[model samples]
Target: MSTEVAQNTLSSLLEAVQPPNGGRNIHDPATGELVARAPEHGTEELDAAVAAARAAQAAWAARSHGERSEFLNRAADAIEASAEALAELLSREQGKPLNGPNARFEVGACASWLRATAALDLQPEVLVDDATSHAELHYRPLGVIGAIGPWNWPMMISVWQLAPSLRMGNTVVMKPSEYTPLSVLALAAVINTELPDGVLTVVSGGREVGERLAAHPGIDKVMFTGSTATGKAIIRSSADTVKRLTLELGGNDAGIVLEDADPRAIAEDLFWGAFINTGQTCAALKRLYVPESIYDEVCDALVEVARLMPMGNGLDENNVLGPLQNKAQFDIVARLVDEARAAGARVLIGGNPVDDQPGYFYPTTLVADIANDNSLVVEEQFGPALPIIRYSTLDDAIAMANGLDVGLGASVWSSDPAQARQVAARIQAGSVWINKHGAIDPRVPFGGTKQSGYGLEFGVDGLKALGAPQVIS
Candidate 1:
């Protein structure tokens, strides 16, 4: 679509969602300018959406898988058609640069995920077959699915949950993060163009609405992606209804640089892995452990790469890094870096925020010579700050990497894939990368171990997660 058409589409979507008396005003995190207002839905609206979804589920499920897949394909087309408009709105509201692997990448990901989910083969399994008797295992839709998404990658993550649920023949009722509700709402508006009425709906509200939706009798399953604390709360709330859940919560991922690794060769990848989405990614590398032999080398290489990346307003194509999505996140990044500086850690580059800056723009910070127990190293500073710690031995490095209670993802960087694989086997994370960190593929299953939360999210398993298993003879 042309830029003019895309803008018109976005404007129409915002107008449709805005309440008559106005609703919550969303502002640009990059410049503190008013972007738009999102509807402040509550429990009543939640009930109506769920009721409509529940009413639509049976007919949606009754259709053949091929028919459902076709609908998903068309939804993907609609998302692509409005890709430019969606990216612009997402950049303005979510504080991600329009270029690079930020807003446009996220918008494109939504469409790609839709297509991937639609194309996945999910045939019934022949559990048992004897001469006189036969049995088959099949997956059926589980009524209405409640998808609660995070703000970091609002549109893409919503597709991660919504596409599979819809493809499995279940209708979805989504509750987007309050910080970036407009992005999700706009995305739902584009997607709804290709879907049947009530097949998908977005309820942009506060925590109460989410709490009610999790426990609501009409919602058979809840798929949530957010903080660990909120995931725990959902667990408690959903218990009364015995609702099934798939939670992808907080991740303080770690990365290790082996003694034999080439620091210069891996510096750029390491920097992007940790700082992608300006470090708001749950699976982004929060802690780095480097052997003393190449500690300074690795730190210097990372600093050099970090210095080249420009940070500014999201609309500026020359910039790759943007502000934290909200003030609370900015405070967390600022506070953790401050604590690190006070604790005598060395700031390599971009530790201090520009006081005169208009928005919540914390500079990309890299701290070295930090202790493993330091708050910055231990905590999930979901922003553009990385804590690099030095270790004397490989054993010490492995122990420090595994020290955290949450292990969603971890990476082992080395010249020898064999050695990396050996080290990877010892780590406790759900997904371990040999050379790259947080390189998630839609075809691969991704989740977390321990407090990072459970249940797989991609590939065939992700499709099955949204369905109820039954055996027929």
Candidate 2:
């Protein structure tokens, strides 16, 4: 379809969405342009969507896995075909770089996830094969899933929620975060066109809509990806209905660079680790612990790479990093960094919003010599500023790393892979990497520990999270 026609189609879908919390303008954070107006839908609309999903779910569930896989494959094909348009929409709405690996990576991930989920098959397992008795384990679909997605990687994260639910034969009524709902609505339209009505629905909204979805009796499961505070609220709201929940909450991930690590060799990876997607990622390396022996060297190396990386509006293809996804996030980054600086932290590279920029464009920042109690070191900044903490002993570093209540992901960098792996085992996180941080695969299970979240979201284990186990004899 022509760009104008495609845009009109997206506009029609946005108009049709029933935002319950009333209406709000969706702006491109990178350019501060009004892109779309979204309604924060309320309980009535949520109920209607859930009921429709309930009606359509059984038929969807009854379809053979192969048949359902076909639908998912078709949706994947559609996404891949529209990768550019979707990436543009994502960049405009979510504020990630359109050309550089930001928006395109997320859009491509959606298509990849659908295709990967379709490729998976959950076969029945035979537990007993005696002469006279036989037992087999079967995976049965949940009727409907209520998905509440976050804004950091809107399109990709929704796919993380929806693809598995669809593969396991469940319908979904999803609410994208209020700040960036346009691309999600557009994505839902693409998927819904290939599948049966009500199989997947996107209703963009804020807190009220999320609460309604979590509490709705018709929703068999609620899979949420956002803050820990919100996840706790979802648990409380869903308790009365006994709804199944899978929450991917906030994370204050820590990365430890070993004393023996080559500062120059890991500099680029380290830069991307902390600032990928402008550091809005839940599993982004928010805190870095380095031995005092090489602390300044590591800082200098990171600055050299980060200073050279392109930072600008997402519409500019050459820019690698765009603005924070929203103003609140940008402010959070600013406040945390400012607080750290006031507390005697040294800014090695940057700690300011781009001057004269209309967007929420905070520069990639690195702070050093911050105390342990500094909020920039303690809390999940979820933005572009990263605090580098120096530790004289590895024991002290491990203690500080494992001391946090939020444990989503952690990484250990060392030239000796064995030592790194051993150290990684001590980090209290759902996933730990020997050298890389936040690198995930569709075949590997990914989630968080402590209050980060409960339940997993990828791999065979994740697919099974959307279904119930039945044994027949």
Q: Against the true structure, whose lDDT is highest?
A: 1
Each prediction's Cα lDDT score?
0.92, 0.87
TM for every model, in the order presented, reads 0.97, 0.95
Query: Residue 293 in model 1: shift from native, Å?
Result: 0.7
Give me the displacement of residue 151 in model 1, in angstroms. 0.9
Steric collisions counted per model: 0, 7
Q: Taking the tens digit of each residue's C-alpha lDDT, what string does model 1 give over 396-472?
A: 98999999899899999999999999999999999999889899888899999999999999999988898999999
Total residue pair clashes for candidate 1: 0
| Model 2 residue 220 CA deviation in Å | 0.7
Model 1, 437: alpha-carbon shift in Å? Answer: 1.2
Q: Can you list the residue pairs that collide in candidate 2? A: 19-39, 19-40, 19-41, 20-40, 20-41, 20-42, 21-40
